[model samples]
Target: MAKTIFITGASRGFGKIWAEAFLKRGDKVVATARNTTSLNDLVEQYGDAILPLQLDVNDRAAGFAAVKQAQQKFGSIDVLINNAGYGLFGTIEETSEQEARDQIETNVFGLLWLTQAVLPVMRQQGHGHIIQISSVLGVATLPVLGVYNASKFAVEGLSETLAAEVAGFGIKVTLVEPNGFSTDWAGASAAQSQTMPEYDGVKAAFQAGLTDDSFGKPEATTPAILKLVDAENPPLRLFLGKVALPWVKQVYANRLATWEEWADVATAAHGH
Candidate 1:
């Protein structure tokens, strides 16, 4: 059966690729971007199979309105790809107040609003899947990406809670955590703070850790995403790219060891 997929940030990168993949496979797509004109080619090619809407996900009203338009056109939304977010590059000390706030507004609140908007519709339908585009930074941290890490961490927590809360309503939530990808995510779409002299060394070390092979190709993710949404039982969390799982595994193992190392102190602090 053909599914109706609503995607945010569909103008380029992974979102655009996934949208085209879905449309090519005979699914109806509601493709949204800040500038709908960027989607003109998809509209031209897919015609009635695609609905291109202009949406700034940070605007709560606009998000709900977009959902309404999607439902009106497609009858029901089977899947929602919450892919509208960008990375903010800076160390915690170098990050500005406004940059931090802007990152949260789009990544956390914008996703929250759209998830809330679709809940009722999915509830009525009794089945829906919500996919949040998070990052490997959500689980692990790196220098010069403090604000971006924080934003993705917020997304991780929010989406995990959402998964549990909406399970009863037949709503499935998945957090797609990708490591570095050769997308505009780290290029044109990224927001960067002015560099601080003190952090120059830290920044260089961070850059030195990355290699040409670190990033996965954006288009290569199409098949993985397609299979993810098609699963009869999708996971609550899915990691994209070859590097994501190995990195996360090491990070998690260290966390577990540290927690166990301090388990006695933690227990004592919770005295009955």
Candidate 2:
């Protein structure tokens, strides 16, 4: 049976690839981006199978409206892919307060609003899949990607709770953690704060190593995602790429180690 999928940030990158993959599999896609103009090619290619709409997930009303329109058009959305997010590269001190807020608005709050908008419908229907496009950074924190890391870390927690909350309602939530992929993720459109003088050497090294570090391919994870979408008992988390797996494992281990090491101190403050 072909499913109807609603995907955000479908104008480019992994979102666009996923849209195309779903269409190729005979599924109907209600794809959205901030502007639908660039999606004209997809519209021409897939015809009615691909319904491109303008959406900024941060706008709660707009998010709700998009879901409503998709439901009306496709009867109901079988899958919702929250893939509308950008990378924010900068140190904590270097990034402006507004910049950090914008990162949260787009990456975390937008996802939350959209999920809320669609949950009622999914709960009523008693079946739906929600896929969150998180990053390996969501599991681990790097030097300059603090804001992006924070948003993803929040997503990790959000997705876990959502999965437990909706399991009884026959809805499933999966977090997709992909590592550095060869996408336009670090392109001119990426948000970057000015390099602080104290971190000049570190920033220079990051810039020089950018190309070499980005090794994963977008298509590499598409198959895993499609499998998850089709699986009857999908995993709560899907970590893509070999490189990402190790890093994520390391992050998890580190977190566990830290908690264990500080357990006595942490419990001391509780006054049990």
TM-score winner: 1
- The sequence of per-residue lDDT tens digits that candidate 1 reaches over residues 60-140 is 999999999999999999999999999899889888899999999999999899999999999999999999999999999
lDDT of 2 at 97: 90
Model 2 has a clash total of 0
lDDT of model 2 at residue 58? Answer: 91
Residue lDDT tens for model 2, 1-272: 99999999998988889999999999999999998998898889889998899999999999999999989888888999999999998988899998999999999999999999999989988899999999888887777888899999999999999999999999999999888888889885489987789988777876686565566888877898899899998888888877788766777898999999999999999997
TM-score list, all predictions? 0.98, 0.94
Model 2's TM-score against the true structure: 0.94
Q: Specify the highest-lDDT model's number.
A: 1
Whole-model lDDT, candidate 2?
0.90
Give the alpha-carbon lDDT of every model.
0.93, 0.90
After TM-score superposition, the amount by which residue 265's alpha carbon in candidate 2 deviates from its true location, in angstroms, is 3.3
Residue-level lDDT for 142 in candidate 2: 75
